[model samples]
Target: MDSLCPLTDAVIGDFAREDAAQLYTLVGRGARSHLKVLRNGLEISEMAVSDLPGNPNAVWTVKKNIEDQYDSYIIVSFVNATLALTIGDTVEEASDSGFLPTTPTLGCSMIGDDSLVQIYSEGIRHIRADKRINEWKAPPRRQIVRCAVNRRQVAVALSGGELVYFELDLNGTLNEFTERKLFNADIACMTFSEISEGELNSRFLALGTVDNAVRIISLDPNDMLMPLSTQNLPCPPESILLIDTPNDDGKGVAAVHLNIGLQNGCLFRNTVDNVTGAIMDTRTRYLGTRPVKLFKVQVQGRSAILCTSSRSWLLYHFQRRFHLTPLSYANLEYAASFCSNQCAEGVVAISASTLRIIAAEKLGVAFNVQSFEHRLTPRRIAVHPTKPCLVAIETDHAAYTEVTKTIKRNQMANDVEAMATDETEAELAREIAMNLREKKLDERVFGAPRAARGKWASAISLISATTGEKLTYFELPQDENAKCLALVQFSKHPDAVMVLVGCGVNEPLNPNTVTPEEAANRPVRGCVYTFHLSPTGDRFDFLHRTETPLPVGAIHDFRGMALVGFGRFLRMYDIGQKKLLAKCENKKKRYRERERKRKASES
Candidate 1:
C-alpha cells in the first residue's frame, strides 16, 4: 500500500514555480511586487519589480523555459495593449525588453512556446514572437468570457454559453472560425491539453460551467470543439485542471486527470478517457471551506497531487484505484499559493510571508486523516414510445433509506448512548424502520389488494419535442411511492399507454404476524398501474392495477411479453394468458463478487 509522506516546508510569496535548480516567485506586499529567488529552500536574492505597459490587473501566462532551450517570458493582455516581459538569467532577474503594443480588455490569455493567443472582451487576437500576427472580431454584443489555445487552434467561450473554435494558420494567424452551443450554459473556466506529445497528438478542452457541469470537447481536426461528454457536479465549479498522466505502460495521456475545484472548498478528481473524454471514475477530497488549486506532480517515478486551499495546504500521494493518501498538511496564516515543478519532485509553496521548497520525499503522515468520499451514482433514464423524447428520473433520495437501514442494523450492536441523539433523529429512525417492516410484510404476502393510503405525490410533465415547450402536467396518487415509468409502444395499436410502477405498504398483511395463512393470502406491495393518454394529450385516465412480487424499478416488452425488473430479479409474464412465462434471478451476489474480482485485478 502507498502512504502519504511529508517532505519539506518553507515561507515566501505567492505565484511560485520550481525550475531545474531554483524556485521563482512574484513576491511582495501591498502595491509593490518583487522577484524572489530561492535555492534549496533558502531565499537567495530579491529583485525589485518593474511595471510594464498596460493595466496590471490583467490575465497573463508565464511560458517558462521548461526544456532549458528557450527563455521564459510573461505575456499579458490581448491585441494592442499586451506586452511580454523577459525573465533574466536567474529567478531574481526581470527585464522589460520584450514589450509589445498589445490590446487590452481581455479575460483570458494563452502563451505558447513562441506564440500567444488571447480572448478580449469582444474579440480574439494572435501574436507571434512579440509581433501582432492576426485578430478576429466576434459578433456584435457577444462578449467573450474565457478561452483556451494550442499551437494550431483556439477555443473561445462566449458569455451566451456558446463555444467558438478557430483554426490557426502556419504563421500563427486565424484561418477560420466555427461556433457551436451545448446546453447553452454559462462557462466558468476552461483549460486545454494535448493528449500526447507530437504532431499527430489529439487535443482536448475541458470546460467548467456555471451549471455545475464539466464537458470535454475534442479538438481533433474532424471534430473541433465537439463535446464528447459531460459530468454533472454536486456544486458549482470555479476552475478546471487537466493533467496528462501515464498509463500502466508508461505512456502519457493514456489517462487524463481532471481536477475540478468547487466553490465549497471541495475538489473532484476524475480520470477521464483520453479519446472520448468520458469520466472513468471519480473521487472527492475536501480541503477547506474555500477554493482549491490542483497541481500534478511526479515523485520517485510516480504521479501525485499538490493541492492548495485557504489557510492550509496538503500534499497527497496518488495511489492505485483512485486512492489519495495524504502525505502531509500545513496550516498557514495567509492563503497559500503553489508553483509546481514539471521535471522534479518538489514544489514552491507561498503564503503570508513565507516561501518554501516542499519536496515530495520530505512530506510526513498525519494520523486519523479522513478522505471526503461520495458515491458516483447513475441516474435512471427512460425513453418515450413513438415520441422522440427522454425522461431522466432524479433518484437521489432512494439511497437515504438504505443508509438508514445500515444505521438501524448496527444500532443494536453498539452502545445505546453512542447511538442516542436528538428526538427528531430518533423519531425519524423509528419511522424508517416501521416503513421498511411494513414493506417487507406486503411483499411476503404477495396476493392482497392495495388499501387507501396516506397522501404522497409526484409529477409527470409532457414536453413538446419541436418547440421545447411543456405541454401538460399530471400529479401522481398520494398512496404509493413512484419507482419507474415506461411507455408501451405497440405498432399494431393506434395509441400508446403509460405504465407506472409504485410500491408502498399502505396496509399490513396480518399485522399480528401469528396468522401465517392470512399473511400468505395478502397481495404484494409492488403495483403496476396503467394510464390511458387522451387524444388531445393533456390528460390521462387511470385504467387498472396489478400486484407484483417485488418493487419493479423498470419494465420492458419483448416478443409480446411483459419483462419486469422486480427488485433483484426479472420476470416475464403473458398478459393474455395471465400466467408467468419465465423468471430469472439477477444473482446480485455473484455479480458483486465478479465486480470485486475485477477491481482487485485492476489494483
Candidate 2:
C-alpha cells in the first residue's frame, strides 16, 4: 500500500527514466515530412510509424487527444512534466502550457477540476518556476504537489467518510467559480457513467467507499441537493471496473477484485441494468493466488477480462467452466499503469506513453523467432487497443541484448519460420534449442488462449510481440558486467539492425578519488558498442563504436519520431526529412515573426 505505482499514465515510463536518454531519429520508408518523435514511450525496439500502401492516414502512435476549445495536448515528455497546447487548434500563436504553475513538478492534482482536485503536497517542484507562480503566496507553502487535470469530475474523501463533487470551470480564473457538493463518505474513487443528453439529473456516478460499499449518486448540477440511488454490495469491493453490454436491456457488469493474500486473488462480477437498476447475474471466480498492489483491470467482453500488474498480466475468459488463463510472460520488474484505451473488442492495452490508440487489425508471423539464454525479464508493456500486437519491455541500462534460455511456455500454436542461416544466427538457434530442449515454452508462460495473440515480457530483459500468429522475441545483448542490455537497435543497412550495448564507467580510477580539477583533466569515459547485425546473423560488421555527446537516459523509436527525454527536456525528432518543407517553413516563420512583434508591442 505504501508503494504506489507512481504511474498516472501506463504508457510512459517514469519521468526520471525517460528523461535520462538521448534518442536517434530516422526516416521511415514512406510517410515523409511528418512531425513525430523517433521513439515513443520507453521501449527497446523502435516504432514502425510509417503507413502502409493503402492507409495514408495511419500512424504508429497518437501523441495527444483534443480536449476541446480551451485546450489540446501538443507536447508531453515525462521528463519535462510540461504539456504544450493550443487555445484551440485553429487559434494561431495562442498556445498554453499545462504547467499550471510553470515549474518542474513530481506530482499534480485537479485544481481546475472542481471535483476531486483540491491540493496535493509531498511532491517535487523546482525553485525557478515555483517562485514566480507562488510569489503571491500568503501562507507560503514552500513545497507543493501536483494533481491530474482531465478526469472531468472530482471526488474528495474527508476523514470521516464523506465524498463531495463540484462543477469544473476552465473558462475563467480559478477564484470566480461555483462549487457543488456531491456525497457523504470516504470515497475511494468515483467514475461517471451513463450520461443522458438534455437530462442533466439523469447522469449516474458510481462511488466506491472505504466501507466496501457501492453508492449510485445521481445529480442535476442545476439543482444541487440531489436524489440518487445508493446501492450496497454484499462484499467489500477492493477494485471496481465498469463495463457496458450492448444487450439493450440497459445492463452492465462490474468486475470486483477482492483483496486476498498474495496467492489467492478472487474476481467477481455482478450484472445490473441501468434503465431500471436491477441485479441480473452475480458470479464469483477465484482467478489466481498473487497479491497485486498496482493492477489495472480492463473489460473486453462479459467473459474476457485483462488484469495487468507488475509481476504478470492475465486474460481471464470464462467459457464453460471458470478458467483463469495465464498469458505467457517472463521477468518484469516495474509496471506503471495500463488501460485498454477504451477499445475492448479485438485487442486493447495502453500504448507508448499511455496515449491510447487502435492498431491495425492484421497480424503476421515473424520470419525468425527464438528464445535467448540470458533469461530476459520485462519491465513495462502496452497493448494496442484495436490491434493484436503487444509491446513488453524491460528497463534499459545502456544498449545491449541478453540471450535468455529460460523458456516459459504456455499454450502452443502452429508456428513456422525460416531459421537463421549464418554462423552467428545458427549459433543463436542452437542456444535456444538446447535451452528449450527439456521444457516447452507453453508450460512456463501459461494462462494463454489456444488461439491467443498478444504480447509477453519477462525479467526486464526480453519483449515478445505477437501479431496474430506471428511472434518476434527481442533479447538483450551480452555485456561485460552481464547486467546491462542493448537499448537501441538501428539498421543503417536495410538488412541489419544496429546494436547498442549498455555500459557504465567505473569511478575512483586511482586508489583515492580525484579532485574536480584533476578529474576534469582526465574524466572517465562511458562505454557503448555499436555494430551491424545482418539478417543472416553475420558477424558484428562494425563493432565497438561509442556515441558522442553521450546519450539520453531514455530512448524510444516510434515510426519516424524519436523521443529522447534529455536533461529534463523532451526532444522531438522529426525523421520525415532532413528539413521542413520550404513553402511551409517560410509561411510559418513569417507568421511567428509577426506574432512575436505583436506580442512585444502589447506587452
Candidate 3:
C-alpha cells in the first residue's frame, strides 16, 4: 500500500518509561472483580480481589516511593470503600470515611504525590494519602456533566450550562474561583488548555454546548470565566481542542489554533486571537459520514490530531504541507476515548470491549488502489496529459472465451498429429486423446462449447486518477477486443483531448480445417476508434473510426500525430487529412541500421 501516511502497531511494553506501559483497569463486577495490568494494549498480569465491593466507580494510578523510577499502585474506589493494590503485591484497604456512602465517583485526577481529587454527583473531594480530606459542594439544583483537570486548575460543567472554576493551591487545596452560566444552552463537553512552564494556571477553556456552538473563556485571573467569543455552528460539536503556536510577531502573545469535531462528521478549523479570543480564517472539511471525535496525539515526537469517525484519520504536516489521510492500521469501531499521556509515541484506544495501542511511523511512499467490478478485467491504462483522469482497456467473459477457444483448437490439432506418429509414443498419445474425448463429452453435456460463445467484448473506461473512481465507460462493438489505448490531441481539435483505442476483430479459426500456411496468410482486419470526453469528464462522445487492413496492435502520440502499429509495421497518419504521413516496415536491414545508429550516438 502506497500511503500518504503509514502507521504501525506499537510493540508490547514499548513505553517502559511512561504510564501507558503499565495500565490498570477493573474487569467484571462485585465478587468477580479482577485487576488487569496491561503493557501497551496486551494484558501482562491479572489479580482477582474479591474483597472489593461492587464495581469500581473510579480507578487511577498513584506513584509509589520511587522518584527516578516508574513504579505505581492502583487505587480502586467503590461506593463504600477504597482499595489500594500494589503492583505484583498485596491489596490493602484505604480510608473511605471522606466519601459519601451513596455518591458515585464520576471522575478522578491526581494533583500531587499525596493529593487525589474525585468528582461526585453532588460535589468534589480532595483525598490525601495521610487520610486528610477537603471538599466543595456545587450550588443547589445543579448537576455536574463534565470535568477537566490540570496541574493547577479544575473546570467543571453543569447540566444548566453553568461552568465552575477552582484553583489548586500549592498545598493541594481547592479554592472556589468563579462561575458563569451560558445563556440558552446546555453543556456537552469542555476542556482546559495545558499549563505551560512557569505558568501557574491554564490559559483558556473551550466549551461545547448542545445548541451547536462553542465558546472560548479566558482563564486569566483578571477575566476568570469571562466569555471571550462564541461561534455558532451547523451541528453540535462532539469534541474540542486548542493548540498554542509560537508568536511570530514578537508580541509576547502566542496564537492558538482551534479545532472542533461536529456531530455531522465535519472538522472545523480556525485561528483564535489569544488576547481577544475572536475567531478568524474559518474553514471546514468533511471527513466521514459518522460523528467525528478529535484527539491530540504524539506521532514521531510531534503533536498531531487523530480524528475518529467511520474510520480513523490523521492530520499532520510533512515537508511544509499538511496531509490528512486514513490510518490503515487502526479501525476504531465505537471507540470511547484515546489516552496519549500513557504513551507519547502512540495511543491507547479504549472501546466498550477492547483496548488497542497503536504506534505510528512514516512511510516512504503511499498509493491507493480502488477495485472495479469483478466481471471486468483491466488490461492496459493510459494517463491523460492535461486532465486528472486516465483511460483503461477492460475485457469481459466473452473475450476470455475467444482466447480460450483459440488455444483449445490449436492443442487438439497438435494431439491429432502426435497420435499419427511413431508407435513408441502411441500409449502416451492415446491417453491424451482419451482425456480430450472425455472433456468434449463433458462440454456437450454442459451448456455449450466455448467456440459457440467465442465473441469478444471490450470497453474503454474513463477514470479519475485523483480518487481512483471510474466515471464512465464506452463499450466497443461485438466481437472486437481492445488491444491498445492512448490519449491524444489531434490537429482538427487541438484544444480538446481525446481517447484512441486500437481494436482487433475476434475470428476463431479451426486448425483442423485451415492449414498453417493458410492461417498465416489470412487477411487481418481492425479499427482505430476515436472518442472525446465531455466537459465534466464523465462520458465519452463518439468522434470517428478508421478501418485498417491489419490488426492494430499499439497506438502512441508522435509529436501530435497518430502513430498506429500493425502486426509488423508502424504508420504515422495526419488524422485531419486521413492521409498516411510516414511508414516504417519491420525489415532486417532497417532494424540493423537503427540499432547501429543508436549505438554510434551513445559512443
Candidate 4:
C-alpha cells in the first residue's frame, strides 16, 4: 500500500501547471478540448485549441514559463508540429511546421524566456521571441531523439546514438557546438545539469538509452563529452530525475542524487560523485505493474516520488541518499494517462471524467489506516530523531470482527457454484447467490482481525509525517494493553532508545463467568513495561516491567523521577530512591487569580 495508489485518470493527452494548485489538461481527440483543475475538482470549460490561430488538435508537450512567475505563459507543442504560447484565455502562435516549405517533422522541443528550440528530422531550429529563425543541420539522416535545455546550455540526444551540446554565448552567438558519440544504442531521454561547488566544476549530461542502460556523461567547457559511467537496467529506462542538495536561496547544488524509472516498473536510486559523475551507491525497487512517470514531488513538506502509471499513483519515500522506499499510494478510478508538474505538492492528472490533483499528503499512504486494516488505531506517536516522521504505537480495538479471509474464500467458492450449477436449478442457484451477497455484506460491515490469522497484538508503526507513509510495523504480544507510551534516548546509547509503555486494562479478563460484584471489585493493577528499540528503529526487545499501586493515566520522566498521573491524584517516584515520594490530589480550580496574576498598580 505504501508503494502503490489507485488513481482516476481523465485520459488527457498532456497537461501543464504553474502554481501548485492550478492545472490545465488537454482533452478530447478530434476536437481540442481542455480541462482546468483548481485543487478541488476539474472544470471542463468550452475552450478548444481551435480558438487559437493554428487550430491544433493533439498537445505533445506543455511547460510553464519560468521567467514570468506572476502571470506566467504556458508553452505548448502540438502533434501538428506547431509551437504556441498561451496565457489566460489568449493564445499566440510561436511557430508552425505547416508554414515551412518542406513541412519538416518535429521530434523534440525546449522552451525559454524569449526563445524556443525545436528538433526535427533535418536538424535543430531556434525561434527567437522577435520571430528570428536560426537553423543548424544535424548528422546525416539522423533525427534528434530527445533534447533538454537549462539556461544557455542545451543537450540533444540523436537517434543515431550521438549527443550534441550547444551553448549560447553572452554576445548572443552560438559557439562551436560539440558532438560526441557515446551510446551504442539510441538515447530515449536525457537531462542537463550544471556544475556545483561539490562537483569540482564538472557539469553532466545524464542519458537513458533504449538498450536499458543509463550513461552519465561528464562535460567540461573545454573538453569533449565523455562517458563517466554506464549502468545497465533490467528494462529500458523511461524517465530520469537528478536531485541535488540545495544551498541557501535554493539554487546552489552540492551533490548528484539521481532516480531512474524503467519500462518494467522498476525504480532505481543512485548517488553520483559530482566531480567524476561516477555512481557511488545504487538501490532499486519495484514501483508498479505498468510503466511509470517517475518524478520528485513535495508532499506535505516531505520529498517523495510520484510514480504515475497506467493503473494508479505510487508515491515512494525519497531520501537525499538516493534511495526509493515504499511510502504510500492510492487506487484510482481510472489510470492516470497524463500528468504534469510532478515535482510539486499538486500534480494534475486526468482520466475519463476524473480530473485529480494528486497531492502527496492527501493521497494514499501506508500510514493512513484506510490504506490497510481498520482494527488497529494509533494511540501514541513519537517523532524520529533525524527523519521527518513519527513512531506510532497503535493498539487494536477488539470490538470489530474482520471477515477478510473467510469472505474472500467464500466468494471464490460461490463463483465455482454459480458456474457449475444451472439457472434451471432455481433453488441451488438462488441459494448460491444469496450466500454470495451475504458474504459480501459481512465483509463490508465487519472487517477481519489479526487474531483470526493466529496473531494477536498491538504494534509500533514508523510513519513519515509529511507523506503519511507507514514505513514499518512491529507487532507486539497482546498480553498487555499499552495505554500511554514514551521514548527516551540517552547520549551514551545513541543507537537505541528506551521505550516506556503504560499498561491499562481495556477488557475484562473473565467476563463470561464472573458475577457483577466480582467484576466491580476487581483490582486495577497497573504496570510500566520497558523495551529497547532496535538500532534501525524497526523492532523492539522487551526488558522488564514494574508494577504500580494505581492505574496510570499518563507518565512523564522529570529529573530522573517518573511522574505518574492517575484519575484522582498525581504521584512522583524517584528512580534512585526506588519508591514513591509524594502524591497530590487534583485541584478543582486550576488557578488562583490574585495569587498567580498581579495587577500592574499593585506591582
Order of candidate numbers by TM-score, starting with the best:
3, 4, 1, 2
> Which stretch of 10 consecutive residues in model 1 shows the poorest summed lDDT?
369-378
The model with the greatest TM-score is: 3
Q: What is the descending lDDT order?
A: 3, 4, 1, 2
| Local distance difference test, each candidate | 0.50, 0.32, 0.61, 0.51
For every model shown, the clashing-pair count is: 28, 93, 5, 20
lDDT of 1 by residue, 1-603 (tens): 322211111123221122112222223211121222333321111222233332343333344423443335444443356555453443332344233344554433334456655566767766566665566788888887777665556677777788776765655456655457554678888877643765633477889988888998887778767789899998878767787666666655456788887888888888888657788689887866667655444454555555555534343434433334333334222111123232134443333334333454333332322121111111233435544333322222222233343454455334433454988767666666556444443321342222232222333444332232344444444334455666554333435545444443322323454356644654336666555555544445565666776656677765554567765667654432232334444535467888999999999
Top lDDT prediction, candidate number: 3
Candidate 4 achieves a global lDDT of: 0.51
Q: 290-333 in candidate 4: lDDT tens per residue?
A: 66555444544544455544334444333333233232333232
**Which candidate do you rate higher for TM-score, 1 or 2?**
1
Which residue segments of model 2 deviate by more than 4 Å? 1-96, 100-152, 169-185, 194-202, 221-236, 247-264, 276-280, 289-306, 309-327, 330-603
lDDT digits (tens) for residues 1-603 of candidate 3: 322121111112312232222322223221122222232221111112133345453454444322413324445556655555443343344344243445555556566555667777677888676868788887789888777775567788877877788887776678877456555787777777766556777788889899999998888778777889999999899878776644434356555778898999899988988668788889898877788877766544445677877656777655544567666433454221222234334454433233344555553223222223312345566656555555667654344343454467568856775767678577667667666645444221343343233356577777654344668767776677677888777776687777888887644333266556655765347788888776556667777788877678898877777888876667776564343344444423467788999999999
Query: Candidates' TM-scores?
Result: 0.43, 0.32, 0.48, 0.44
Q: Cα miss at 367, model 1 (Å)?
A: 9.6
Q: Which candidate, 2 or 3, would have the higher TM-score against the true structure?
A: 3
Q: Across residues 1-603, which tens digit of lDDT does each residue of candidate 2 receive?
A: 312122211232221122212121111111111111122221112111222122111011111222222222222223323333232323122142323333333322323322112232322211121222321121244332212122343333333443334343454122311443434545554445433333322245555665656655554455442434444554444444444334324345433222211213455455555543444465655544443212223233342334433323333333323333333322121222212223222222233333222221111211111122222223334333223333333322322222322222211111111366678877776666555455444422452222111111222211122211213443333322212333233222333344433332322324265677755764433333343344433223344434323223444543433334322334433322222111111112356788999999999
